[model samples]
Target chain A: MYRGLLWLCFLPSLLFGQRTDSLRIDFRPLLNGVALELEEEGGASAGAREVEVLRFYLSELQLLEGEEVVFAEEDHHHLIDAAQVASLQLPLTLPPGLRYDGLRFTLGVDSLTAASGVFGGDLDPTNGMYWTWRSGYINFKLEGTSPDCPARKQRFQFHVGGFQAPFNSERRVTLAIKPARSISIIIDLDSFFAATDLSQQYQVMSPGELSMKVADRLTRMFRVE
Target chain B: MRQGVILLVVVMMSGLAFTLSSPPGIAYPDHFPTTAYDFRAHPLDSAKVQLGRRLFYDEILSADGTISCASCHSPYNAFAHTDHDLSHGINDQIGTRNAPALFNLAWSTSFHHDGAHHSIELQPLAPISHPAEMGSSIGDIVRRLSEHAQYRQAFSESFGDSLVTGERVLKALAQFQLTLVSAGAKYDRVQAGKDTFSVQEQKGYQLFQTYCNDCHFEPLFTTGGFARNGLRVDTTLNDFGRMMITALPEDSLLFKIPSLRNLSYTHPYMHDGRFRKLRQVLKHYASRDVRPMPISANEQSDIVAFLLTLDDRDFVFNRNHGFPH
Candidate 1:
């Protein structure tokens, strides 16, 4: 009877230890209900617009159980490029039967990485995410053409980045999630257009108050549902 | 005596290992402070430095192959463009600011007058892609270098791979630049107790300590901080210095405080190269409305005489830093 009880106690732990599950985080770029495609005009309240580029760095990803941290990916820096289909999907393995209520992540590179000099992999200088004149990487890049903009080609380029105090453009996002094997995180471009006046403040190639404001708005655009 | 023989052999082997491990480059005086650069991230290799030296002198880095880094940063001029008020780039385009002298770069925390780049490795990208400079993209340079037989071999030898990447290119350039340690000047000799300063030089040194030491510190000759040295805005250029990078109002007109070392060879001083002579520089410092530190003409001449003691002829004429054959 004691042996049977011991087996009963050991079996659950053994099964749980062997049960490692993989979860997929799908980053879907959308304008209302429609999918966002580069160089394609999409409807907005102001007028029609075409997204030329949409790229950003997602870092310090963590899974949380209530207020307690359960799982965290150390040194995780991923560049999500809307132009590339493969970059939109990130696959992560989770511990067996570990209950996670929410996900938290930073929308930019850490200040430590910013000051450590040139890096390879996703943070490579050749990736074009890095600023040529300045040292910091562009945490988020969104370039599009809007009819409301008076600039040449009607282009609006927003390269947001800065790790220094006061002007830091990095944003933290905490998303509540339901228990699921896969999660689709929708990034609505419509909200981004609605939050700012594109005509007056179109080009933001450097770090400043403008970039921080834009980055703040970006933190609100992600929806876990 | 067998144990003694074994000990001698072991010692000889360890000495060989030590020599092989530590590449021959970048020796400074004990008085000099440790460098800001993390050498372990990109360790010094003689082969990489040699490759970088070749790349530095090669015009292939430019879009039209008409300009090179050496074009503006001439070796004889202590790696600074002389005579030109502004740096000249490809297609005869004039840059906005003067090209600063390049030496003792491993110790520098930031690059350019604006302090835009934090890393020495990332600094080259600015000139390479700037329309007013080399007018070439990193991708194009990589492609071009990949096609070249010599560069391909060199890249393979340096990086253990045939691929010529932008990271490797930048790292190699940084390695070559890190080898540029200018601590062999007469001032350095005096500091080392090998020589003595003249009476005029001693007086100037004291004056420099009193008036100039706040920004231009001892040993490294720079505090490596930005300062508003009271130069009026040029109506034509309208350069606001560090404010352009930080977008902060308080940082206005604060350009990088350049090192006093190699000033004898690197003439036409300051961010804009406004003064051709050191006397003019001294005069401006003495007369400027913004926090001016006044010094007499005699004192100014003495300071200039002492500045001449910082000339490192061995460094400027060092064949290693010159054009690779």
Candidate 2:
């Protein structure tokens, strides 16, 4: 009778479906080693710059085991906003008892989805990720204020996106990993800011040579901690 | 038995809701080509169309709540402005190009004179965010719509919730535009065998088929392709139409061909609205640098007569397309 009672309990759980676990990717915005919170001044290591906004799209997240495929999010496009704490933490639902040794995700939205028209949720134009005059998603947006920047308000804006060929900026970021409660990923902004000459190369609002290079450099800043 | 009965009621109620909320079938003439807009992606609903119409006429879309889509593309003008040659927008600022007419838009593959926008869903954002146009961002507009009680209710009715999202707003706008089909003209009646064109119109039709048919294709009256029509570049504007978007030298001076439908109501034609009369347009075409037409004065008059047949008064005067009362 006890066994049958336990089976009844198990039956309801089975009805719910799937003995699954989720992998949480914790994205930490760091100026070198220190976390830069909001519009707060980056520490001495970060060249006294202040990051106002940092948002980018992480799409088609997948878990890989060597050459074998483990899990794939075929149509997933996640907008990771540094301002929104929850938006940075990406949780991936996994199949039961699945084991993976590697992680792979596209750093930006694909050209097909960019051309497909308006979409709701994270991909929605309301998210402020889409370009208005030109039809395309701004895949990686980083706006900040630096004393060295030669803009009107000392503001530096890098809205990196170009889905069309010859300047396609979407890049795949694959990181070798080990299974754990959460995957720690750090976006080192210090290196990103250091590489640019803020005086001349601060503004990148449209798709072209500058935005494409910024997008390429952006894909390299994602490091597994 | 109880479960089955509940399911049946749910199904029936859904059917009832669909029948009540969705408008009647869109009646396209048999001669019209397949729609460029994939309707299967976002099916037309009456509630959405109504919601879109309200938004279109509402000045709240602008930053200062002074301008609306109808401000430039009025219903009485066949959705194209007449008071100005160039588009007028927020803060009494003038725009670069003419506001194109808004009818039979479902067949359009691209938006803007430059074809910068690929889809209708993303087209409104151009004017809404342009500094000289509505001068409002999509983010600001979403917030404004969310705060309004009537808009909230309308959104709920249209989309099954009070979520004033960019996608919903854009989709609703697209739905309303797609419903603005103008196949009720005398040209359509002639094509449908219900009416016969006058002798003058018939001769104009032959001329139109011979010379003008390549660019302004039949039925929809637009090939929906960009062409370099050899109009001298406006020195003040210095606009490089298709080349501005593509950045290719070959695409320089190429502009999206405007539809020939509703030429009477939508006067002051051309991409720049340089010609107030059809005679000037014909004259310019004949004297144009590229592929100049050899049309004469009498031929221009006959062509104008045939062009007048393309005007559909029913479409321009449709009460459904006007501002929401």
Candidate that would win on TM-score: 1
lDDT of 1 by residue, A45-97 (tens): 35678787899999999999998889898987999999889999989998878
Local error of candidate 2 at residue B189 (angstroms): 1.0
lDDT, each prediction? 0.89, 0.87
TM-score of each predicted structure versus truth: 0.92, 0.91
lDDT of 1 by residue, B2-104 (tens): 9999999999999999888785546789889977877765668888999888889999999999998999998898899989889988889998899999999
Worst 10 residues of 2 chain B by lDDT: B18-27
Q: How close is candidate 2 to the true structure, as a TM-score?
A: 0.91
| Lowest-sum lDDT 10-residue window in model 2 chain A | A40-49
**Lowest summed lDDT window (length 10), candidate 1 chain B:** B18-27
- Candidate 2 residue lDDT tens string, A93-146: 887779999999888898889879789888989888888887788999988888
Residue A218 of candidate 1: its Cα lDDT?
Answer: 85
